[model samples]
Every structure is written in C-alpha cells, then in structure tokens.
Target chain A: MASHTNENTELGKLKQKIAGLEKLEQQHKKVEAKLKTVNKQLQASENQLKAYNEQLRESEQKLNQQKEAAEQSREFAESIIDTIRQPLLVLDKNLRVITANQYFYKLFQVSPESTKGNLLYNLGKNQWDIPELKELLKKTLPEFSAVEDFEVEYQFETIGHKIMLLNARELLQKQGKERLILLAIEDVTKSRIYKKELERLNKELEIKAEELQQILYITTHDLRSPLVNIQGFTKEMEASLNDLKKLLEKMQIHPAEEKSLNTIMDEEIPEAIHYITSSTTKMDNLLKGLLSLSRLGRQKLTFRKLDMNRLMQQVLDDFEFEIGKNQVNIEVGNLPDCMGDDLQINQLFSNLIGNSLKFLKPEVPGEIVISGGRVENGCRFVVKDNGIGIPREYQEKIFGLFEKLDPKKPGIGLGMNVVKQVVEKHNGSIEMESELGKGMKFSIFIPD
Target chain B: MKKELKIILAEDDEGHASLIKRNLKRAGLMNEIIHFKDGQETLDFLFQGKKDKDEIKNVASLLLLDIKMPRVDGIDVLRKVKQDEFLKKMPVVMITTTDDPREIDKCHELGCSNYITKPIDYDKFVAAIRQLGLFLLIVEVPDLNNMI
Candidate 1:
C-alpha cells in the first residue's frame, strides 16, 4: 500500500510540472503573436518611408530642370541685347552705367570696367560728360518715358567732331526691382557734314553766276565801240582815194611820173589797204567770237534726249566736203545717248571735228574716230584724231580766249574757249591728251 | 525869223563824230552840227548853259545821243531831258555800238525818237546812216522858241 501511494504522489508531481510547462508554452505563443503584430507594423512604416524618399527625389529632379531653363533663358536674353548694332547701355536711375554692349565699348573706346558701374557722364576722360547728354539723361529722359533722336554733338580726341543721336527708354527691371535707362547712340556726323558742304557749294555757284553776268556786259559794249570806228575810217579813206584816182587819171603826166603814180596806186597803196582790211577783218571776227561767248552765258539751256550715233553721223555728213578733200577715214563706234542742248552740242562737235580736219598732217591720210560708252555716274566720249598733235607749251593756253596755235589760219582762236564754256554749261568736262607729231585725243565726261 | 535847224551830236568818241559828219555831208544834209565830247558837255550845251545857247535854242534841232559817255550815261541824260518840259520834244536819237535787246528796249522806253546800232559791216553802216539822212529830210521839226 505504501509503495503504491509513493508512486501516485510522484505521478501527481510530474503531472503538475507538465501542466506548468503547458501554461508557459501558451504564454509564449501569445507573446509571439504580439511580436508578429509589431513586426507587421514596422514593415508598414518602412514602406511609407520608401515612398517618402521617392517623392523627395522626384521633386529635386524637377527643381534642377527649372534651374537649367532659367539659366538658358537668361543667356538668350543677354545674346539678344548684344546683337543690336548701335551703342547700347543699361544704366541705373542714378545715371550710373550698369552694363554696356560691345558697340558701346568700341564706340567710346573704353573697356567694360571703365564703362560699367561708372557714372555715364564721367567716362573716358570725361568725354561723355557732355552737357546735352547730361541734360538728356538727368532731366529730359526722367521727365519723359522715352527720348528719341536727341542730338548730342561732341568732339572726341580720336574721332574729331561727332554727332550722336541718343535714344533712351525708361524701363522697370522685373527681377532686380530697379528703374533702368536703356540708351542707344547713333553716329550721324558724316551726313551732317555732307549737308553743310552741299549748302556751301550752292552759295558759291550763285556768286559765280552773278560774276558771269558782269563779264558779259563789259565784253559786249565797251570792246565793240572802238572796233566800229576803225571800220568806218577805212571806208572814208577808200572814198578819198577814189576821188584822187579820178583827178590823177584826168591829168597828163610824164612816163616816169605815170609809172610812179601807177605803182603807188596799184602796188603800195593797194597793199597797205589790203593789210588794213585783213587786220580789221580779223578784229571783227575776234569781236564776233566774244559776242557769241557772251550770248552763251545768257542763253537758257534747252535739254533734250540726243542720240549720239545719229548726231555723229549728221556731223560727219555735214563735213563730207572736207572729209572728201582730205580722204579721211572715220570710224564711229558704239555711243550712248545723252541729255544735252542740241544747238550747243552741235556747235561743240562742229568745232572739234573742224579742228581735227584743219590740223591733219599733209603727208598722211587722216583717221578720226568717235567712240564712247557709259562710265561711272556719267558717259565718257573719246574723239581720237591721227593728226598733228598740239605742242606741250601751248596745250594749257589752247583753251584760253583768243588763243591761236597758228595765226596764219583763218580761225578766230575762240573755238576751244567756246568748247570749254559749252562743256561747263552741260556740267561736263573735256580733257586733251596729245604729243607733238603723234596724235590728239579729247575725252569728254558728262554726268548723268 | 528863218533860223536853220542844226544837228547836235553828243559822242564820247571823236572818230564816231567825224564819221557821222562825213556821212551826213555825203547824204546832202547841209545843216550845221554841234559836237559835244561827253554827256555833261552835251547837257551844258543844251538848256542854255553854253556861249551859243541862245542861238541853239532859237533854231530847230535834232539831238543824236550816244548811250555810253564819260561823267554821265545817255540814259541819265535822257531821263533829265524828258523830265524837263522845255527839252522833252528835242527829238533825241540813241546811237550805240551795243545792239543788246535790253538796252534797245530801255532806250525806247525812255522816249528816244529812234535807236540805231553802229553796224560793224561797212556797207550796212553807211546804208543805216543814209536811211537816217533820208528820215531827216522828211521829218518836220517844231520851233521850240516860238512855242515858248
């Protein structure tokens, strides 16, 4: 019985111990379930953190793209400002230059350091301190939103006098939050000088025209009065000789005396009268030349389209007799039409061609060529003659009034003078090229 | 009183005056001629300033005036003479070497009786003087002293 109770106690104890272990095991499972719940919560928090990290990275990428775009736009705006041709400047409201373009640096002959951030009127050795510029920027531009074509005339040491047209615009800078002045400068000195020169030339031309009228008056009246008297006295002397001749014819005379009277009347007296007549004729021709030249000054020019080819043909035809006598070969080349007075041009060509025909060498056949074409802002005509060329000593004087190369010739020596006058009337120029015993070439340039 | 009409030739040039006198003789104009060297002398001879002023004033006369003269021009003399009522009807003829149309028109505007340009051609000049001679023979002269 004692052995059996002992066994039973031992079994109870063991059973109790086993029950405690089971309890411990159940408690451990509950603790493990709670731990699983906590681990799931931790995983959920980590996923949320990863999503937050991705969002932060995307926002940072977007920020970088915006920054790049802003930089590119800024660069493009600066390039646009640089492309303007005129000198451009950006200044603060205080008239301090904030920035200047490359043209501004070049035009003012200054570096960016000297120009930028410097007072606009105190730059480049105070060359920019012009009262007009100061007045415009400080007073005029501030009063107005924009100043256009405000002229500032200043003298620069390097560039001499300069006329600058300033254009200014008042602008509000959006980013910097400041008032800016946009200044543009244009140089117009060349055009201003051209206008001044043109006015001066016009005044000179008016004075010259007045003087020409005075010359015409003196040449016509004062010079011709004495010539008329000489002509009248010669006629009186001839009448007296006729009466003396009749008286001598009625008287009976010795042979020797008759011979003496006949010689005196026929040879000596007739020779003397011939010289006087010829001299008077020459003087009369010279006076007529002067009159014609004077008349040219008063004549109103009638401008018309003139066909040079047809005119040359007509001029050549008019000289057919002379040409035939001289056996001259004339070549007419391509010629351009010109605007001129027909009568004066006809007279000019007549004199020129007549001179060519007159000066032809006796030993050789004459070659006369009339040729020309359009040139720079004008037409050029060349009259080349293979004839006796003018001497170098007489070349300059040939165009003078009453200048004669050959006194024995019948011409009054006014042909070249009239030619020069006519050329001047047409606003053209004639230049002679010659070498003695070689040839003569006259080139005429007439402006369109 | 039958006073002969005289011709008064006012010329600065002596040769022109001689030519006129000789040509007038050739054309049978036998009138006595009085010559003046300049415009001032011509003015003095007329308007009763010269020694023979009374004789010249009593006679019927014609005045031939040159446009160009020393001291005073022919236009000034014409202006002075035409301004005076007594000398206005003196029948002045303008003789000049200048055939400028402006000068000719100016002389005609000044009441010149005739305008004659001294011709450079010998035959034409003599013919022009002869035409003047023929005109002198026919034109009637008013007696100034009788009218006064």
Candidate 2:
C-alpha cells in the first residue's frame, strides 16, 4: 500500500507542473500583443511630428520672399520721387514734410536734414509761410480734392522774390491710414518778368509812333505861311523890274549905259526872277506832298471788298496815255479779291503802274504783268515789269521819305513813300525784287 | 439916292493888305475901302464906333474878313456879326489863306455870305479879287440903320 500511494503522488506532482507552464506561455503572448499596439501608436506620433516640422519650414521661406518684395517696392517708390525734375514734396496730414526730392532740396537751398520731417511753413525760418499759400492749402485744397496752378508770390530769405505755382494732390489711404499730400512746385518768376518787359516795350513803341505823327503834322502846317509870302513877294519884284524896264525904254540915255541897263533887265534880273519863281513852285509842290502824307494818318479808311480785276483795269486806264507813249504791253492775269481801303489801294496800284511806265527800258518794248492769287493768310499780288530796275545799293533806301531812284525822273521823290504809307495803312507787306538794267518786281500781301 | 457903299477890309499881314488894296484898285472898284489891322480893330469899328470914324448908323457897308488874326479870330467876328440884328443883313465874305474844306464849311455854317481862299499865285489872287469886285457891284448893300 505504501508503494501504490507513492506513484500517485509523483504523477499528481508532474500534472501541476505542466499546468503552470501553459499559463506562463499564455501570459507571454498577451505581453507580445500589448507591445505590438504600443509600436503602432509610436509610428503614428512620429508621422504627425514630421508633418508639423515641414509646414513650419515652408512658412519661413514664404515670409522671407514677401519681405524682399516689400523692400523692392519701397525702393521703387523712393526712386520715382527722386527722379522728378520739379521740386516735389510728400507731406503728412499735418502739412509736415515727410520727404523731399533732390530737386526740392537743391532749389530751395535747404539741406535734407533741415527740410525733411519739418512743417512746410516752418522751413527756412518761416519764409515759406505766405498768406496766399496758407489760403490755398487750408481753404482751397480741402474743397477741391486736387489744386492746380495755385499761385503764391512770396519773398524768400535765400532766393529773394519767388513766384511759385503749386499743384497738389491728396493721396487717400484706406483703413483709416494717415493721409498724405503730393506737392509739385513750378517757378514762373523769370517768364513773368520777361512778359512784363515785352509789354512795357510795346507801350513805349506806341508812344514814340504817336509823337512822331504829331511832329510831322506841326512841321508841315507851320511852313506854309512863309512859302506863301516868298511866292507873292517874288511876283511883286518881277512887276517892279518890268516897270523900270519900260521907263528906261522910253527915256533916252548914253548908248553904253543903255546897253548895260538892257542886259541887266533882260539877262541878270529876269534870270534871277525866273529862278525864284521856279524854285518857289517846286517848294510849293514839296510842301503839298508833305501835307498830304501827314493827312494820311488822320484819314478815315473805308474798308470794302474790292474787285481786283476791275481795280487793276481802272489803274491801267488811268495810265493809258503813258502806256501808249511808252509803248508798254500790260498783261492782266486772274486777280483774287481782297478787303482793303478803296482810295488807298487805288493810290498804291496807281503809283506802282506809274513807276513801271516811268522806268521802262527804251531798247525793249516794256512788258508788265499783274497777277494775283489767294495765299495762306491773305491775297498775294505780283506786279512784274520789264523796266530799268533799281541798283542794289539804292534798294534799301527806296521806301524812305524823299528817296528818288532816278534824278532825271519828273517825280518829287514822294511817289514811292506814298505807296509805302498806303501799304502800311492797309496792314499789308510789300517786297521788291530787282536787278539793275534787268527788271523789277513787286509782291504785295494783303490780309483777306 | 443910295448912299455910296463903304467896304471894310480886315487883314492881319501888312504885305497881304497892301497887295489886296492894289489888286482891288486894278479891278476897277473905286469904292472907299476902310482898313483894319486885326480882328479886334474890325470888331471895334463895327460894334463900338471908332473915335476918328463917322458913326456907322446909316452906312451901307460890306465886310471882307480874314481868318487867323491876333486877339480875336474871323470866325468869332462872323458869329457875333451874324447874331446882331443890324449887322446880320450886311453881306460878309470870308477871305482866308486856309484852303481846308472843313474851315470853309464851318464859315458857311456860321452864316457867312461867301467864302474865298486866297491864292498864293499872284495872277490867281488878282483874278479872285476881280471876281469879288464884280460880286460887290451886283450885290445890293443893306443900310444898317434901316434894317430891323
């Protein structure tokens, strides 16, 4: 019985041992599954961390590019402000200068250190604080969003007197940002002075012309009284000489003495009287010409549309006797109409035609051509004559008073002067082209 | 019988007055000519009678007035004479050196009977004086005292 009890005890011991071993194996498998779950959670956490790091690096690179672009734009704006030629200023809402262009600093004679960030009125010891400027900036600019050509005349300390035309623009900002103003300055002092000088010269010229006219009128009128007396007294002396001659003829005297007396009456005394008479007549004609010339300034001009063809025909008809005598051939071309005084224009053409007739070359049959057409601003008429032309030396003096080209000619040197006066009165211009012994041409332009 | 008509000549220049008197005599005008040196003298003779001259109450007279005189002018004399009751009927002729048409028109507008421009040429001046003499012979002279 002892042996049987010992065997059962040993088998029961082995079974218990085997059962413990199986339970241990199951616990080990459960530990391995927990480790696998922990490994999966660690892999998920590593992926999320990598994604956050990549996002942070990308954001840093974008921020650097944006900063570079902002810096470039700011530089571009600065370059634009500096490049303008006119003095330019950028001001804040308080009218304090934010920045100034290089031109502004140079023209105002102010350094950038003293100019920038200072109130515009306070700059240069308050020299820019002008009433007109204050009115424009304070009152005019706010109502008008933009101000153009706001003139301010101020006495500056450095520049003396300055006339500035200010143009301002309000640069509006969004989101309640500080508003700025763009001020552009133009200096018009030199141009204004030049204009004033020109006006003064014009007035002085007008006064001089009026004074000349007055002098001419007074001189011509005062000379006539003495001329009349000289002519009348000359006639009286001639009558007295004639009476003395008759008395000597009736009385008997010594032959030699009578011969000398007759010679005195016939040759010397009569010759002197004849000279006096002719000289007086010539002086009378000259005085008459001067008087008429002075009167031309006061004559009323009646402007009318003139038929140039008819007028030219009338002028030719007036010269018909001379034309026939001179054997001149006149060609009348198509003449354009123009507005002018009738009597003055008639005188102009008459004088020209007469001059042509007088200066005709004897060797050749004289040829005169009158042609006209509409020019750019007026009517242009050409009077071309194949006649004795003026010498180049005398050409410049032909329009002056009492300038006669040909001494042998019968005129008193007043014809050409009258022609010039008539042309000036009509506000017309005349140009002459001539070569000695070749031909003469007159081109006249009269406004339509 | 008509009283002999007396001619009153008003001139400023001595030479012009002598020449005019000679020319008028040559024109066969034998009428007595009374000369005055200036417009003032002529006015005094007509308005306030001269101390040495007879009273001009019944005198039949004609006036030849020259313009451009000292103290007073011919136009003033003409205006005053034309305004007067007795002197207005007396024929007045304007003789002047000025040939300006405006002065001639002004003389006519001021009631001068005739206007004549003195020619500088001696023959023309004699012819003008002769024409004036002939006109004076034909024109009827009004007595100053008889006119209203």
Write the residue-wise lDDT of candidate 1 on B21-70 in tens digits: 88877887888989998888888767665456567667888888998898
DockQ scores for all predicted structures: 0.46, 0.31
Model 1, A1-448: lDDT tens per residue?
Answer: 9989999999999999999999999999999999999999999999999999999999899999999998999888778777776889989989899998887788778999888889987888888878888888888887887999999888887667999899999996688687899999998898889989999999999788867866866766677777777777777777788889999889989988898889998789878877876677777777777776776777678888899888888888999999998899988898998889876887788788888998999899899999999998878898989888988988999889889899877888989899888999999999999989987899988777
Instruction: Pull out the clashing pairs in model 1.
Output: none
Classified by CAPRI criteria, candidate 2 counts as: acceptable
Kindly report which residue pairs in candidate 2 clash with one another: none
Model 2 agreement with the true structure over A232-315: per-residue lDDT tens digits: 788888899888888887998999797888788899988988888777677766776776676666557889999999998988
- Please give the distance, in angstroms, between residue A361's alpha carbon in candidate 1 and its true position after superposition: 27
- Shares of reference contacts reproduced by the candidates, in order, are 0.66, 0.24
Per-residue lDDT of B63 in model 1:
88
